[model samples]
Target: MNRRGFLMTASAAAAGFALAQAPGAAFAAPVRKALPRLKTQQVGSGDINFGYHSAGPEEGRPVVLLHDFGYDIHSFTEVIPLLAEQGFRVLVPYMRGHGSTRFKDKSIARSAQPEALGADTLTVIDSLHHPEAVVAGFGQGAVAARAFAQLKPTRCKGIVAVDGLWRPVPERAALQKDRRGFARKLWTANSPDWRFDEAVFARAAVSFDNPDFAAILTDTPSNAAVPTVSAPVLTLRGSASGIPVDDPTARMIEGAGHNLPLEAPQAFADAIAEMVRNAKWRT
Candidate 1:
């Protein structure tokens, strides 16, 4: 056979082999099973019943997702299917104090320490029976992912942080001054209709009740621990207004600051697909 013909045959053979090994193809070969709907699953040290939503085959490669505070798993609604379409099983859990995840004892305060959240995540993984899985987080969710990866380096297959606001979040006392400044800026930026009750803002702020949350927000600007993650870390930051500077991983995106899934879901989904593919390649 001519050299060119031989090369073409080899390439075709390789492609065929790859297709058979692919999760999508593998599932197609077998009898199809019904995929489950979004449901509550009890996981982690807190034994919290977390609301989980997923796409793609359960037997496919696992990619665990965590979302920012004040947002539910729905924050990732736009990105999960893309990952699944790429042949990855996406797992998103409601973090402690958010959505369906509640403290074991409602009376006991849930501390937002990286270690605590990390431990809880580990517990969830154990409960799910996945020996190893990729972990990714968005916004404040990135902090929990970083902590989880740091604590369970062996178990964490890969890590991705998107538009993390790890920068200094001012304490309430310090925020007093900024509040006035922000109020003045708001006054100039919009009409009186924009004015909202201070009580509404206060309730929103209290959700991040743990002292560590405040400490990290305030110190995140200089904090580099997030980049120290031993697992492959993919950091993404949006470019538009309100993008925070505290992202710890390598910044990978721009043009849609802060709210990546909302402002630019396609870009966000692509970033996650790349991270999962790269992570699988590395492993």
Candidate 2:
């Protein structure tokens, strides 16, 4: 086999191992240990039960950090401490189909579309009873972050979307139909970073076989979404990542990619700090 063929085969295996998904199927989710500082708690919102980790000063400025699709609250283990020490109440919740967060009514739709994620995020924000919060998200979570910022501007004070917004989110309907193929392609392109960071998420990624990949991948981006964000917004990505940067507040870090939180924690933290500093929140 040629170099390209060899590379393709390797990537397919890695993505298969990492995401554990079939074409148009849910990703698998792994079990994870609880953090000492992060209190494990659940909030019943509407018919959904959201399990999340929370720490830091409750009276301090609130910040809600959402993890990428393949990860859970544990994703922000490193960054949350920093913000907490700096007097920020950090809340990291599992997405709809990841971790302990779940829908109370099985009869309800399980679609993880951007709109659904946006609504769920709002539920979390309201349950926490934070009048407003600085919302930050990575990858799929970033899309959720954008939706939250646009749809719930009154509750979302500012948004810091790293490797999430203003990027080329490929709309491939076929990917949903062939999730395994999508995993192969995605992992092939993403394995280099995965190899370096799976340790942070792998064991806890048991449910990698369950997230709504197709609905997420093929979900349409609303043309009117960006203009609706009344709160401040900051878009960021790694310089090495080919993802686009179209926002005025867009920023970049050298040699980073979708896994910016792990590959560049300091830079990611810096970006969040910058977002909070520039946010037009009430004093």
Off by over 4 Å in 2: 1-39, 165-188, 191-194, 207-227, 242-249
lDDT, candidate 2, 29-118, per-residue tens: 343454233457898668678888887877777788887654556657778878878777788887776667767865777764566777
- Residue 16 of model 1: what lDDT? 20
Tell me the lDDT of model 1 at 250.
54
* Cα lDDT of model 1 by residue, 51-170, tens digit: 566677766677788766443465465677778887876778776655556556545545555666677678776766666677777655777777778887887777777644333332
Candidate with the greatest TM-score versus the true structure:
2
Give the per-residue Cα lDDT of candidate 1 at 103: 57
Model 1 misplaced regions, further than 4 Å: 1-47, 165-227, 246-252, 280-283
RMSD of each: 17.1, 10.5
Pairing residues by index, what is the TM-score of model 1? 0.63
Candidate number of the best lDDT: 2
